[model samples]
Target: MNKTVNQKAWFLVLPVLILVGFSAVIPLMTVVNYSVQDTFGNNVFFWAGLDWFRDMLESERMWNALGRQLVFSGIILAIEVPLGIFVALNMPKKGFWASFCLVLMSLPLLIPWNVVGTIWQIFGRVDIGLLGYVLAKLGVNYNYTQNVIDAWATVIVMDVWHWTSLVALLAYAGLQSIPDAYYQAAKIDQASRWKVFRFIELPKMAGVLMIAILLRFMDSFMIYTEPFVVTGGGPGNATTFLSIDLVKMALGQFDLGPAAAFSLMYFLVILLISWVFYTVMTNLDKRDGV
Candidate 1:
């Protein structure tokens, strides 16, 4: 006799399916619909076909924003990964201080994105903000609102401050998962600190490091709220990324057709890059038997 498979699990997942349909699928369909059509007053729409997509692709504004976005993401990954690993390596493996450090690291991640932006915005003001005031008192010229380099530097530093803890916590968890026996074995071999880290600890942390890199890459690439709030894509668009450009096209300029097309392309670019990153990293992991 054949045993009947239980099907009740489908019912358990039905609510999530419905939620995703409403939250993601429906909105995506709407964007796709808008992308190929032009609308005038009173909701009259005409077929625009690929005109908007072509316009966006040829637009120098979009290309500039994409470049800036890539640079920002690259800088973030470079700084956060190494800094996070250093912090993790120094943390106490088993102690009350470990718990305290974990809590301290989590505090930054707990802050709302908009709030983080706001805090940085205020913190960078030259007339009143502590950082700007202190810098000015020391004869350093720092103004994010008006200077291109300052704006970029402020945004990068703010991002590092707000998100570095996430990387640290992930690395810390990976470090904690290594067995004490690995350390004992390394000690018996009279391994140097560098040798122990290179031969054992780094390998053990590979999986979590992969996760941290991916998460940070995606987040930094799509960053909007923080920079938008802090710099408002100011100083002659020096800090304007793709997301800000899209918002300006859609809401600031009210070019719905172009904005929709721009958004679709933006989504695809992000998806493609993220897929490539995942593929490369996973293959490396498999090669090393991670």
Candidate 2:
């Protein structure tokens, strides 16, 4: 006789399916509807076909925003990944100091994103902000609002300060998973610090590092509120990444069709990059028998 399958689990999953339908699928379908149609006013929609998508593809403004977004994400990954790995490697392996270090590393990650933005906005102000005041006192030109370089620097630094801790924490967890036997073997072999890291620690942390990269990349690529709160995509659109530009199109200019199309393309780019990363990671795992 055939064993009975647990068909009852569908009942348990039904609520989640309903919730997802309302929260994600419905809204996504609405966006798809808008993306292919244009509206004048009073809820009158005209079929625009692929016009909006074509316009977004050909628009220089969108391309420029895309370029800036890529650069910002690249800079974030470059700084945060290496810095996080370094911090993780140096963290205390055991005891009270380890606990203390872990707590310290976690503090930044716990702060609200908008609050982080607000804090940085004030903190970089030239008037009463300590950082700005000190920089000015030291004869440094530090003004995030008025200058492009200052705006970019402040945004980059703010992002680094806020998110580096996440990378460190993930990397630390990866480090914690390595058995002491590996370190002992390395020590017996008289492995230098670099060799231990290269041949042992790095390989062990590869899984988590991949995770860290993907997380940071996606977050940085979609970054909005922090930079918005801080720079407002100002100084001649120097910090106007894709999200800001999309918001501008949707709300600022009231170009709903273009905005919807832009959003869909944005979603696709993230999906594509994430898929690539996942595929590479899976292949690497298989190669290493992981």
Best by TM-score: 2
Model 2, 1-290: lDDT tens digits are 99989989789999999999999999999999999999998999999999999999999999999999999999999999999999999999999999999999989889998999999999998898988989999999889999999999999999999999999999999999999999999999999999999999999899899999999999999999999999999988999999999999899999999999999999999999999989989997898785
Cα lDDT of model 1 by residue, 1-290, tens digit: 99889999789999999999999999999999999999886899999999999998999999999999999999999999999999999998878998999999999999999999999999998989999889988999999999999999999999999999989999999999999999999999999999998989889898899899999988998899999999999888999998998898899988999999999999999899889988998898788774
- On the 0 to 100 scale, the lDDT of residue 154 in model 2 is 96
Model 2: C-alpha RMSD to truth? 1.5
Instruction: Please give the lDDT score at residue 139 for candidate 2.
Output: 96
Model 1 spans > 4 angstroms off: 1-13
Error of 1 at 56 (Å): 0.9
Model 2, residue 168: distance off in Å is 0.4
Q: Give each model's whole-structure lDDT.
A: 0.93, 0.94
Using Cα atoms with residue i matched to residue i, what is each candidate's TM-score against the true structure?
Answer: 0.95, 0.96
